[model samples]
Target: MSLPDRKEAEVRRMLDVPHPAVPPDLAARAAERGRRILVRRRAVQAVAWALLLAAVAAFAVWAAVVEPWVVPPADTTPPLDGW
Candidate 1:
Protein backbone atom coordinates (compact mmCIF):
# COMPACT_ATOMS: atom_id res chain seq x y z
CA MET A 1 0.00 0.00 0.00
CA SER A 2 2.81 2.44 0.97
CA LEU A 3 4.75 1.75 -2.21
CA PRO A 4 1.65 2.33 -4.39
CA ASP A 5 0.90 5.64 -2.59
CA ARG A 6 4.51 6.82 -3.06
CA LYS A 7 4.38 6.02 -6.78
CA GLU A 8 1.08 7.84 -7.14
CA ALA A 9 2.53 10.95 -5.41
CA GLU A 10 5.56 10.86 -7.72
CA VAL A 11 3.32 10.61 -10.76
CA ARG A 12 1.25 13.57 -9.57
CA ARG A 13 4.37 15.68 -9.06
CA MET A 14 5.62 14.86 -12.55
CA LEU A 15 2.29 15.80 -14.05
CA ASP A 16 2.32 19.16 -12.19
CA VAL A 17 5.73 20.26 -13.54
CA PRO A 18 5.65 23.75 -15.10
CA HIS A 19 6.11 24.02 -18.86
CA PRO A 20 8.86 26.27 -20.31
CA ALA A 21 7.72 29.74 -21.35
CA VAL A 22 7.55 30.66 -25.06
CA PRO A 23 10.54 32.64 -26.41
CA PRO A 24 10.06 36.43 -26.97
CA ASP A 25 10.89 36.03 -30.67
CA LEU A 26 8.09 33.47 -31.04
CA ALA A 27 5.49 36.11 -30.07
CA ALA A 28 6.91 38.55 -32.64
CA ARG A 29 6.81 35.87 -35.33
CA ALA A 30 3.20 35.02 -34.47
CA ALA A 31 2.23 38.72 -34.76
CA GLU A 32 3.99 38.97 -38.13
CA ARG A 33 2.18 35.89 -39.42
CA GLY A 34 -1.15 37.31 -38.22
CA ARG A 35 -0.52 40.57 -40.10
CA ARG A 36 0.37 38.67 -43.26
CA ILE A 37 -2.83 36.63 -43.00
CA LEU A 38 -4.88 39.80 -42.55
CA VAL A 39 -3.27 41.39 -45.63
CA ARG A 40 -3.95 38.29 -47.71
CA ARG A 41 -7.57 38.19 -46.53
CA ARG A 42 -8.11 41.85 -47.48
CA ALA A 43 -6.59 41.26 -50.92
CA VAL A 44 -8.85 38.26 -51.52
CA GLN A 45 -11.89 40.25 -50.38
CA ALA A 46 -11.05 43.12 -52.74
CA VAL A 47 -10.68 40.70 -55.67
CA ALA A 48 -14.02 39.04 -54.80
CA TRP A 49 -15.78 42.41 -54.65
CA ALA A 50 -14.29 43.47 -57.99
CA LEU A 51 -15.48 40.24 -59.61
CA LEU A 52 -18.98 40.69 -58.15
CA LEU A 53 -19.23 44.27 -59.43
CA ALA A 54 -18.03 43.19 -62.87
CA ALA A 55 -20.65 40.40 -63.02
CA VAL A 56 -23.40 42.87 -62.04
CA ALA A 57 -22.26 45.32 -64.71
CA ALA A 58 -22.20 42.56 -67.34
CA PHE A 59 -25.74 41.45 -66.38
CA ALA A 60 -27.04 45.02 -66.57
CA VAL A 61 -25.49 45.49 -70.02
CA TRP A 62 -26.97 42.20 -71.24
CA ALA A 63 -30.43 43.15 -69.95
CA ALA A 64 -30.26 46.56 -71.60
CA VAL A 65 -28.84 45.73 -75.05
CA VAL A 66 -29.20 42.01 -75.82
CA GLU A 67 -32.24 40.71 -73.91
CA PRO A 68 -34.54 43.67 -73.52
CA TRP A 69 -37.53 43.23 -71.20
CA VAL A 70 -40.87 44.67 -72.33
CA VAL A 71 -44.10 45.09 -70.26
CA PRO A 72 -47.41 43.91 -71.74
CA PRO A 73 -50.19 46.49 -72.17
CA ALA A 74 -52.75 46.73 -69.30
CA ASP A 75 -56.30 45.30 -69.83
CA THR A 76 -59.08 47.88 -69.94
CA THR A 77 -61.68 45.83 -67.92
CA PRO A 78 -61.50 43.36 -65.08
CA PRO A 79 -61.49 39.66 -66.10
CA LEU A 80 -64.15 38.52 -63.52
CA ASP A 81 -66.95 41.00 -62.68
CA GLY A 82 -70.19 39.31 -61.28
CA TRP A 83 -70.87 36.42 -58.88
Candidate 2:
Protein backbone atom coordinates (compact mmCIF):
# COMPACT_ATOMS: atom_id res chain seq x y z
CA MET A 1 0.00 0.00 0.00
CA SER A 2 1.14 3.51 -0.70
CA LEU A 3 1.95 5.78 2.31
CA PRO A 4 -1.03 8.06 1.67
CA ASP A 5 -3.38 5.06 1.27
CA ARG A 6 -2.05 3.54 4.53
CA LYS A 7 -2.62 6.83 6.34
CA GLU A 8 -6.15 7.07 4.98
CA ALA A 9 -6.88 3.52 6.01
CA GLU A 10 -5.62 4.21 9.55
CA VAL A 11 -7.75 7.30 9.82
CA ARG A 12 -10.78 5.43 8.55
CA ARG A 13 -10.23 2.64 11.04
CA MET A 14 -9.95 5.09 13.93
CA LEU A 15 -13.06 6.97 12.85
CA ASP A 16 -15.03 3.77 12.38
CA VAL A 17 -14.45 2.54 15.96
CA PRO A 18 -17.56 2.93 18.07
CA HIS A 19 -17.32 4.80 21.38
CA PRO A 20 -19.39 3.55 24.32
CA ALA A 21 -22.03 6.00 25.42
CA VAL A 22 -22.13 7.15 29.01
CA PRO A 23 -25.39 6.53 30.89
CA PRO A 24 -27.58 9.57 31.52
CA ASP A 25 -27.30 9.10 35.31
CA LEU A 26 -23.58 8.48 35.32
CA ALA A 27 -22.71 11.97 36.59
CA ALA A 28 -25.34 11.87 39.28
CA ARG A 29 -24.22 8.44 40.45
CA ALA A 30 -20.60 9.51 40.57
CA ALA A 31 -21.48 12.67 42.50
CA GLU A 32 -23.51 10.71 45.00
CA ARG A 33 -20.63 8.28 45.54
CA GLY A 34 -18.19 11.13 46.06
CA ARG A 35 -20.53 12.80 48.55
CA ARG A 36 -20.89 9.58 50.54
CA ILE A 37 -17.11 9.14 50.67
CA LEU A 38 -16.61 12.72 51.82
CA VAL A 39 -19.30 12.37 54.49
CA ARG A 40 -17.69 9.20 55.84
CA ARG A 41 -14.26 10.79 55.89
CA ARG A 42 -15.57 13.82 57.76
CA ALA A 43 -17.37 11.63 60.28
CA VAL A 44 -14.18 9.72 60.99
CA GLN A 45 -12.27 12.95 61.47
CA ALA A 46 -14.87 14.29 63.86
CA VAL A 47 -14.84 11.13 65.97
CA ALA A 48 -11.07 11.17 66.17
CA TRP A 49 -11.03 14.79 67.28
CA ALA A 50 -13.73 14.13 69.89
CA LEU A 51 -11.77 11.23 71.34
CA LEU A 52 -8.60 13.30 71.45
CA LEU A 53 -10.38 16.16 73.17
CA ALA A 54 -11.92 13.81 75.72
CA ALA A 55 -8.50 12.40 76.55
CA VAL A 56 -7.02 15.85 77.02
CA ALA A 57 -9.91 16.95 79.20
CA ALA A 58 -9.60 13.86 81.34
CA PHE A 59 -5.89 14.45 81.86
CA ALA A 60 -6.48 18.09 82.73
CA VAL A 61 -9.17 17.16 85.24
CA TRP A 62 -6.92 14.58 86.85
CA ALA A 63 -4.05 17.04 87.15
CA ALA A 64 -6.19 19.85 88.58
CA VAL A 65 -8.48 17.89 90.89
CA VAL A 66 -5.98 15.36 92.22
CA GLU A 67 -2.90 16.36 94.22
CA PRO A 68 -0.77 13.23 93.98
CA TRP A 69 2.34 14.45 95.79
CA VAL A 70 3.13 13.36 99.37
CA VAL A 71 5.17 15.45 101.83
CA PRO A 72 7.30 13.75 104.44
CA PRO A 73 7.06 14.87 108.09
CA ALA A 74 9.82 16.93 109.71
CA ASP A 75 12.99 14.97 110.52
CA THR A 76 13.31 14.09 114.24
CA THR A 77 17.05 13.32 114.34
CA PRO A 78 18.87 15.43 117.01
CA PRO A 79 21.74 17.63 116.00
CA LEU A 80 25.25 16.36 116.91
CA ASP A 81 26.73 17.87 120.12
CA GLY A 82 30.16 18.48 118.55
CA TRP A 83 31.07 19.31 114.97
Candidate 3:
Protein backbone atom coordinates (compact mmCIF):
# COMPACT_ATOMS: atom_id res chain seq x y z
CA MET A 1 0.00 0.00 0.00
CA SER A 2 1.03 3.67 0.50
CA LEU A 3 3.20 5.17 3.27
CA PRO A 4 0.23 6.01 5.48
CA ASP A 5 -1.14 2.44 5.33
CA ARG A 6 2.26 0.97 6.11
CA LYS A 7 2.69 3.35 9.04
CA GLU A 8 -0.75 2.42 10.40
CA ALA A 9 0.01 -1.28 10.11
CA GLU A 10 3.33 -0.82 11.93
CA VAL A 11 1.58 1.09 14.74
CA ARG A 12 -1.04 -1.65 15.03
CA ARG A 13 1.67 -4.32 15.27
CA MET A 14 3.46 -2.35 17.96
CA LEU A 15 0.23 -1.97 19.97
CA ASP A 16 -0.57 -5.71 19.62
CA VAL A 17 2.79 -6.73 21.18
CA PRO A 18 2.63 -7.50 24.90
CA HIS A 19 4.49 -5.21 27.26
CA PRO A 20 7.53 -6.58 29.09
CA ALA A 21 7.47 -7.19 32.84
CA VAL A 22 9.06 -4.41 34.81
CA PRO A 23 11.38 -4.91 37.83
CA PRO A 24 9.76 -4.34 41.25
CA ASP A 25 12.46 -1.89 42.46
CA LEU A 26 12.40 0.15 39.24
CA ALA A 27 10.01 2.75 40.66
CA ALA A 28 11.95 3.08 43.91
CA ARG A 29 15.26 3.48 42.06
CA ALA A 30 13.76 6.09 39.75
CA ALA A 31 12.29 8.03 42.67
CA GLU A 32 15.66 8.02 44.47
CA ARG A 33 17.47 9.22 41.39
CA GLY A 34 14.90 11.96 40.91
CA ARG A 35 15.34 13.12 44.49
CA ARG A 36 19.12 13.25 44.04
CA ILE A 37 18.79 15.23 40.83
CA LEU A 38 16.40 17.67 42.49
CA VAL A 39 18.74 18.14 45.44
CA ARG A 40 21.70 18.83 43.17
CA ARG A 41 19.70 21.29 41.07
CA ARG A 42 18.48 23.16 44.17
CA ALA A 43 22.01 23.35 45.57
CA VAL A 44 23.37 24.71 42.31
CA GLN A 45 20.60 27.28 42.12
CA ALA A 46 21.24 28.37 45.71
CA VAL A 47 24.96 28.80 45.03
CA ALA A 48 24.24 30.84 41.93
CA TRP A 49 21.83 33.08 43.84
CA ALA A 50 24.32 33.54 46.68
CA LEU A 51 27.09 34.49 44.27
CA LEU A 52 24.82 37.01 42.55
CA LEU A 53 23.87 38.58 45.88
CA ALA A 54 27.50 38.81 46.93
CA ALA A 55 28.43 40.57 43.69
CA VAL A 56 25.58 43.06 44.13
CA ALA A 57 26.53 43.78 47.72
CA ALA A 58 30.16 44.38 46.74
CA PHE A 59 29.12 46.74 43.97
CA ALA A 60 26.86 48.69 46.31
CA VAL A 61 29.66 49.09 48.86
CA TRP A 62 32.07 50.25 46.19
CA ALA A 63 29.57 52.75 44.78
CA ALA A 64 28.84 54.14 48.25
CA VAL A 65 32.54 54.76 48.88
CA VAL A 66 33.55 55.99 45.44
CA GLU A 67 30.53 58.21 44.53
CA PRO A 68 31.41 57.62 40.88
CA TRP A 69 28.38 59.54 39.58
CA VAL A 70 29.62 62.94 40.87
CA VAL A 71 32.31 64.86 39.03
CA PRO A 72 34.96 67.02 40.84
CA PRO A 73 35.22 70.75 40.12
CA ALA A 74 38.20 71.93 38.03
CA ASP A 75 40.77 74.36 39.57
CA THR A 76 42.63 76.90 37.37
CA THR A 77 45.83 78.68 38.53
CA PRO A 78 46.16 82.44 38.22
CA PRO A 79 47.61 83.82 34.92
CA LEU A 80 51.34 84.57 35.01
CA ASP A 81 51.27 87.23 32.22
CA GLY A 82 53.12 89.86 34.40
CA TRP A 83 56.10 87.56 35.20
User: Which candidate's TM-score is highest?
Assistant: 3
Which scores greater on TM-score, model 1 or model 3? 3
Model 3, C-alpha of 24: deviation from truth (Å): 1.4
Q: lDDT tens digits, residues 1-83, model 3?
A: 99999999999999999999999999999999999999999999999999999999999999999999999666877778967
Q: Quote each prediction's TM-score.
A: 0.61, 0.57, 0.77
Task: Give a tens-digit lDDT track for model 1, residues 34-72.
Answer: 999999999999999999999999999999886566775
| lDDT by residue (tens digit), candidate 2, 1-83 | 99999999999999899978989999999999999999999999999999999999999899777755656667898788979
Off by over 4 Å in 1: 1-15, 71-83
For model 1, what is the C-alpha lDDT against the true structure?
Answer: 0.91
lDDT of each: 0.91, 0.92, 0.97
TM-score of candidate 3 against the unseen true structure: 0.77
**For model 3, what is the C-alpha lDDT against the true structure?**
0.97
* Cα deviation of 4, candidate 2, in Å: 20
Going through the candidates in order, what is the number of backbone clashes in each?
0, 0, 0
Query: RMSD of candidate 3 to the true fold?
Result: 2.7
Clashing pairs in 1: none
